[model samples]
Target chain A: MALCQTSVLKVYHAVIEDVITNVRDAFLDEGVDEQVLQEMKQIWRNKLLASKAVELSPDSSDGSHPPPIVANNPKSNKAANAKAKKAAAATAVTSQPQIGGSSSASSLVALKSSAGMAAGSGMKNGLVPIKQEVNSQNPPPLHPTSGAALLQKQQQAASSGQGSIPIVATLDPNRIMPVNITLPSPAGSASSESRVLTIQVPASALQENQLTQILTAHLISSIMSLPTTLASSVLQQHVNAALSSANHQKNLAASKQLDGALDSSDEDESEESDDNIDNDDDDDLDKDDDEDVEHEDAAEEEPLNSEDDVTDEDSAEMFDTDNVIVCQYDKITRSRNKWKFYLKDGIMNMRGKDYVFQKSNGDAEW
Target chain B: MSYQLYRNTTLGNTLQESLDELIQYGQITPGLAFKVLLQFDKSINNALNQRVKARVTFKAGKLNTYRFCDNVWTLMLNDVEFREVHEFVKVDKVKIVACDGKSGEF
Candidate 1:
């Protein structure tokens, strides 16, 4: 069981590294420098990664594994740093063999069989661990209803003496280097006294939300939701909140008169610096506000100019080299009115293939 | 960089206001933009075959425009100048397609 968790951790770490390295590569390919990478690192980690970890990890009925540094609390900053390293390194070797073994088909079948008996979970909102024999190749949209039934079947799969509580990774587990040491500041400098910590991410987090997906089944829900564990950078968190708040806003239906929309949108945007919950009913007009994140960039010297200040027209055209990769839902013709399914991988670091087509004649809902 | 852009004439003020509303959301399509330009120009620059080149940076869609006389650029946005650069104008609309491009030798 411990081996399984360790491997899961390793997989998630790999995913994060791959995502970050890919961003680094994308910038480098465009001849950008390390400063850009450093700037993006915090945003990506805080906005996407840490939240995803909390999203995917199964509810802790998986046994209270020593409460993580509970009694053996480190005394000083140095002591804490040293303790973290020892714990990280000690688990690396034991999990290495499990990582290798899980990749083979025979072991996966055994793991699945064992997991079948470990059924009946206390997951929130009645979410059950995927009990079906997980087939990685043909990934299906695991709807809520289907997930529950699948768990029931898995419980049946577990015969006398063998249980299915432990989910052997049934997805494509990518190879990732276990641990990485990142310096918050340059070594040998005065700031070098700051904690130099070794972080371990589960390679699984990068490769596939395989673990997370099994737990929640809410993959294609909305473009702007995150898990509780989304820690790391405070700046990115605020940005994420702002983005999600903006995206999920109930797009106000534009009337033919457009008088209400004009006034309301103007007021919402003006007071936006103060209240983020300002929802403009007309999102079509507010389309590329995401691009204007330049205003919200904490590191940049963004002028304290409000939308009202740029009187002549606040519109300016910029090149689309903003390093966003898009994965848009091709068939958005679903019966659920209009749903935007974005599997943001660039990190598709993207906002779907952006194309301006078929303008609506005033009375459209979405 | 520090001139009162919306200076003097009624046309300049109206064009400035119109440009803000037109491009407020983003770029408009060429066909849509042409219709918008016609509202400002059909009576003013009243010639059947007067072809116009769009000079960016200056929001003078309503006023009569000039062509780029020399091979030099006209406006500068984000360090890149608006030369005979039609390729960079793909995802964007020609918001200000005026009579000539030779506004100034920047």
Candidate 2:
């Protein structure tokens, strides 16, 4: 059955009323303004009317309203302001790690203080002191190579067998500084990920624009020099583990089916090796192999259900047609293998219009 | 099954959009938004159960696809004709997602 547009609107109004009335106590307990709840309802109604799926009376919105929400539908600009503050704080944190290792520790302190201020203060003016404190700590490097020179000195001191423990303690904090900086860029911007790698060299050692080439060469050489034997051994270990686990599972299955199946166990081992190869090369042939394996080992390991209930609903929304019905099924039975459905409490979006139904009966076959 | 699936419907979608806007403005937390959605679930269920009194009957030329899993039925129909009172609406394709009716009772 089809419902008229007016009834759809009426149902929506009741839903809005019930939701707001029910949720008001929670909002009140949280110390949130009642006005915000009203604003949300107003925005919800406005958006529904804007959909143009149904004609709503213009006077309904204009008449007998209690402080109509701002036309923009935003009640406050707090999150935007917080984002701006966070961006500023992020730049400050990222720049500080380079000055000195000790400074990195202090930058953490500054970050925490700035974050606290950002959260508690509604006024932008409160952030000025925090920014200024961060800026004061970010003194210009004495020389671009000073950090490298310090690292060189630390290494020299360690090699000389002098008190290397203090130098090591100072160096450890800078190594961890990158991890702290990674936390601030919530947007995951590429530019934020690119940190300044200060490479120390004598004036004659580097030419302009050659640094990137040198860096890339070093990176490639390091990658090319990977320990192949160690990697092979690790991979071999993983394969052995999988084979053993698969064999154990097969044994479990065999035991459950019938005892003393040695010949079957040997055949299963060979099949498992083939399954491993198929898993490694997950191509069209692997799917056929998997089906074969499923037929034999169905009792050993049930294949995971690739689609669960959540994705089922998501796929419904993802379906091309908006002509969809979401309802409750009271009974679904097959008479002579022809499907009959009895459904109720349904909401449907069909042909760009909304509908609500109390009962639905449907018939289909195979 | 809960009315969370209804969030895909027009009314639920609009309500969610409104709540999202409020959350973005920092006027509400995600926790409160969740509470609001729960309320919406109950509200929509009750409204549909008690307020709406329409009955619909439909016949499909072909059940293009049918899936039953997790006690839910997802059926894709082709050449659907819905009859309500004296009105008839025909659509080329429609998808039906039905949850167990008795399972959602609170």
Candidate 3:
């Protein structure tokens, strides 16, 4: 075909396939299991279609711009040949890390103080978007109304056969993750195996949602590989740790907000005294007093979830409600079934069995 | 499992030191130590905001020490390095200090 004439209709299937392959390899390298890998692939395919839908202007983005030829469907082309010479011309770009880290400790502190203020003052306006603007490099120039509409569209799409929203996390292998997470044993195993996995803790630059996916993927890989008895406990502990961290952040945020409100009021008071002729001081004072009371109440209030039911669902009928899947391994009979495990005080327990951490021996006894 | 317990103990000790330092420094009240410990991980997250280096150490007595260090903060257990230990120094309250890791008056 190339010898006959220069052709544009011929699709370079290899280029697109290479991109998909890269995605697959990255997820697999990150320890995603087969089922989850399939799920992620589906998400990526949908995303490719979505990206192809919106043709970005050259001015809009730099390296992440897709090829000029936008396919109505991402999977439409099935080209057999993509010459190595042409590959560079249509080289697929690796997307940058979507989530940006807080620049420094000082800025983070400022964010916390502001988060505190927002939570305390009950100021519903601009809190979320502002945070997003700060965190995202290409924070879709969204006005509040447009952002809301976009969110609504996403929710509707999610409701209609779409899977969980995709979470992307970048791991810095150079920096080990601080926590040590244990892995689950293999499915339908006869003997118990002890394989301790100390996951390199992902850095703070990675957000909670991304970290959750990374952890889940690793958990799946571990569970698939080993003959572990403490699969449920491991999941429970890790999830709870993240959950606990979130709750603590909320509490701290609330307290900081109250303090911020009080400080602002004090500053306002000092300013009002400096300008004694300002007649609106009385009205402002009354408003400040009300806000102060509310702030105080907010500061003292506990987090919304007192109970540690990770999913916080109140049903007992389904195994999937908790989003936790536990496989049982019977050593004697060599049988496996869905094992029932529950978390108490953030400790995972096998049903009808007490789990004890032997401090001296450093092994778990059930 | 023993590592978790050991980590917990070391964490507890670090937290105690942090709380005591804060209370002695009049940054936070003494009774709030329990509250602080419950939410110790937050401090860890905040401390991780800075550049840090961590190292793990082992001794003959089944002793494992984790150490963490940053430009402004250094946390250690059993003289080992805690690249992300999130512990108090002999006196600094970077990990234990509530709300921005700078003040206890709140």
Candidate 4:
């Protein structure tokens, strides 16, 4: 009796497995939407759980519990054979309609026989007593539009083959239709696992290029808005240092040139003064012609003074030109007034040029 | 990232790299000191307006000093000796003065 009960449990379990497998495959093949498939799977899972509870019940008196077998060894050949026979019968019933051309009458006979055997066994143990009651109380709802009507429609369309079904026209323009998306799954799992991704269809559903452009423009503007005072300050310092050094070098060069010119002029003046002393000594030697000597001495002295005046004028001109050049360069390079004040206050004016500074009273004093 | 506005190819090294490279490394010598001057000289005659003059003063030696102007820029070395200006070159240390009439300096 125990062997029989175990065999019956095994057979029921196998039937449940077959149903679950079929439902899963149908869901995949039909491209069933996830929400609908999830609801169907939930119902099937509840049914499976309930059936398992019934099979595993310990009380023999419970109407849902199968009969307890009295066999000493439940795994005997007889028990195995009975279980195998039940499985074969179940497979035959399922395969017949799927393979096609099994007459409706034969299919009905097989279904009735299985149903009768299950009912009879269930009644012996008082299991599933409410199943028949429920079936009688409420019949399965009929399709609003019958399957036969749908079949007729399909046939008519096939015969005509001129117009396509108008279902495509019902799609909303704004709706984001599902498209296949492949994304990498978490590591260490099987490589076959794919993440759920909902890709919008029709391409125009997303203005990807425009969105990217707007984002890029905003990023650039934000970055540009940041204050770069530190960097600017460092750059300005370096620039100012460079300019100051250049100005210094320039001043040194101008000073050296001026010194060379001044030294040459000094040497010329000393030579002229020495020549005058020699002419005086010659006049002393020829004292008898006094008027002639005095006339020649006056002539020589006038030319010497005139040459000194010309040299002074030349020196003044050189100073003026140098001043103009240096001032212009300083104004152009250090226009910020930060460095301008520094240059104006520094030793720049003393090289070869005359200093020019406006007094506090706004007087043009140089 | 730091940003800078560049004109007439005078942007130096250390400038942020970007599409601005076209305006920076395109013709500008990197690390050279340059003063920004506002001038409208894009025409052919303006093109021949002569190479922009840059006067630089540097310490030649302890007692020897030098002042020179050149169109080309050279890193560390004398501009007169460099002969050619690289797209990215360094200026050792020198002052930059804008010769144009616009008063505001860089």
Candidate 5:
């Protein structure tokens, strides 16, 4: 049996429903609204659907029929961001007149209408409509960037945890200025401090939940304030760790070239020498040969050190790519250092989609 | 002791991202986000256990690295081939992180 995109979507839907159902009371206990939990689920599902990487058609077991047209325009995106901020801001400014009649019907519906209005006003304001034709029926889609920024800001506030009055002010203006006014200064110093704290703190410093909460808050704030590429930089750091080994090899070859008494070096000969120094000693009669031989022995061990560090960092690298498996090992048997793994309850992310598996057997050697 | 490793998956990342949006807007707290993730752990584990009946088998051309730490097995495989009933998917490299399924209070 194999899981398809639809099945994966179904599993995701089930998981969201299950989580909301279970965590609702806990959140309520913490003075959080049940509606907020539902909204979180909606936002989570919408963002996943927007990825358009997985198909959640109407006929699928996943019953929430996502909006047909994902409008992917600046207008809709702005509207979505504004609506989110307004929703966040609504709690703070209880006096402001709700955009729509009822608070429940207001957010999404108001976003659709307001998105059209914003789009309409933009066109009237000499904003040239390039390829996008303003259609009322097709409201602006929830673009992921605005959604990410929105989340970034939200997490930044949430990290502050309590009495974060400044966040409301930041959102009220609906301009980039507020972020600069509120975040950059404190976030710069705090981010470095928290990062050091996270590094210094042991796994058992606080309760798991509290630790996760603190780390997540720090991570979100730092990520939000990062001026460079956002998520890509985080991922690049991980990839670079693995890449360092390759780079070390390249550097090793370069050093070998210089050590060869400035002779015009052949790449193949250098590679062969690195692999087998004894063979290289017989093959190449070069000056400074003793120095090169001694350097090769030391250089050979550098890659192993690189490999060790890479493996240590492996635990932190996210397995969110298309070709990874997040699962549970029922039992792992090792005979003569060869291992056989029995895995279960697996979510295999492959081929740019997701799959669920009940049982899997993997064969590998130590 | 619900498995939190799945939180690194795409679904988990999206939820965290969404929760971030809510938190940044002051709609929810970081604590609430953590609660959501805990629930997510339980929910996803249960969903995968009860809903998915599919079985898969795979062989690795070479197991690059393997580590067993904290009752979790992390295996990095190169040149792997996965076979399902109907199709097969081959990947250059794949990482498998499996936690103790039956060890926790599910």
Candidate 6:
């Protein structure tokens, strides 16, 4: 029975070893890129160095063992790591010259010596550089770049019957390089070029229901600030607006004159009807014939008299101008219902001075 | 350097001729900058606005003339000058054409 038990134990031990070897081979087959693998090795080395430094320090007393002086304390670990990273980056920048010289050779020699000490210390002194080498050489194929290998190694170390020796590993560090670029220049010489000004107006500047007023104010301010030569073109646009208004007024005046002439002609027709009634009693027998003759005469005279009347009415309308004028003066300038005024040569040339309104009202009413 | 421009026909040629004349008169050149003004009578404005999209084209010789806004008119070769003229004229009605020598037509 004793012999059988011994054989069973041996078989169990052999099986476990095979399992471990398979896991290691699987990691190795995964074939992580050499750069990443090298970086991982460097990180592991740093972690080992840090833990060793912490163990040499006297302040810590966790009862397991004296922690390394280089091991960052839990309380200040994040800040220390950041500072270390910055220091490492600066050193890397400075070490670029050393990369091609004897200094690199000396550093490599130092690294080898330190790696040897870490390996010799074993798990009792909490040094496990050999374990890092073993994992690096035989990383699992399924998870070559995964953190799982590191975790599994930690577990194995813990279960290896090595008492209370703390295991440490490092994290991957981020690196960035600087770059330079240039932009092409725009056409035209600097002296002759016009600069584009973009101004952002906040929504609050436009208050509720006052968008037009605020916009006009902003536009006027910008225009007024411009050089006179540039502002003249903008000012010319105002003249065009005035001309359009004058044209509208002229059309309205012509229509009003036509309406007046039609009313006068209707009055003349009513008078003729009364005159025919007076003549009808005097000659009742010939009244129908005379009425026909009179109607023909009236038709013949109507067009000629209407044309004359239109001319007269137009002349009278031009002279008898009782009209109101509204002119805006501030941010926006506007002239409303000024029929007696005409736009000529970029100016509002008033035909009848008496038609001008002395008082002005705000455009908000319109 | 001055170069003569030749054309086979004159149909729709009034604006092109005017631009060519302006260039010949040394009023504009390939490197010289100048502004152009175009006026469209109400009928023309209505007809073109309803049917055409504005574009500018350049013809180069000893002098370069730029045609703009439905190719109805031509101007000198400054882009900034063209933009200035465009701003002055009512784009929906009249097309203004101008140019500076540096950047051709836009």
Q: Write the per-residue lDDT of candidate 3 for residues A192-237, one digit (tens) a residue.
A: 3424433323343122322322232223444444333355455446
After superposition, which runs of candidate 1 have C-alpha atoms over 4 Å from their true positions?
A: A1-9, A48-366, B1-106
Encode model 2's per-residue lDDT on A95-201: one tens digit a residue: 77544433344443333223322222211121111111112233322332222222222222223323222222223221311100001111223322212122222
Worst 10 residues of 5 chain A by lDDT: A204-213
User: DockQ, per-model, please?
Assistant: 0.02, 0.52, 0.01, 0.01, 0.37, 0.01
Candidate 2 docking band: medium
Report the candidate with higher TM-score, 2 versus 5: 2
- What lDDT tens digits, residue by residue, belong to model 5 across residues A1-366? 346445777788888888888888888888887788777777777767666646665565244544524522332375478778878888767645443333345353333333323322322232211112212332222331232322333233333333322222223222211011122222224332211111222212111111111222224334544544443354234323423433354466545543333233455456533432222221221212323434664565566557776887775564323578889988988888577889898877766667778888978765
Backbone clash pairs for candidate 2 read A1-B56
Interface RMSD of 4: 37.0
Model 3 complex DockQ against the native: 0.01
TM-score of 5: 0.47
Instruction: List RMSD in Å for every model shown.
Output: 33.7, 19.6, 37.1, 54.7, 27.6, 52.0
DockQ, candidate 6, comes to 0.01
Indicate the docking level reached by candidate 5.
acceptable
lDDT of 3 by residue, B9-104 (tens): 222233344344434444345544444343333332222222112221111111121122331111111221111124211211111001212221
Q: lDDT (0-100) at residue A125 of candidate 2?
A: 20
lDDT of 6 by residue, B1-106 (tens): 1001111111012223333333444434322111111111121222222322222111111112223353122222111111111331111111112122112111
Native contacts retained by candidate 4:
0.01
Relative to the unseen true structure, what is the C-alpha lDDT of residue A186 in candidate 2, on a scale of 0 to 100?
13
**Predicted candidate 4 versus true structure: per-residue lDDT over A1-366, tens digit per residue:** 122222333333343344334444444555444454343333333333332322342432455322323221232234356557768988997787644532344543333233323322332232110111212222221321222221222222223322333322244434543422112222233443333223233221111111111111112122222234432333234333433433343343333332222223433323322332222112211221122223444454565557778999985543232111111122212222212111111101112211121100000000
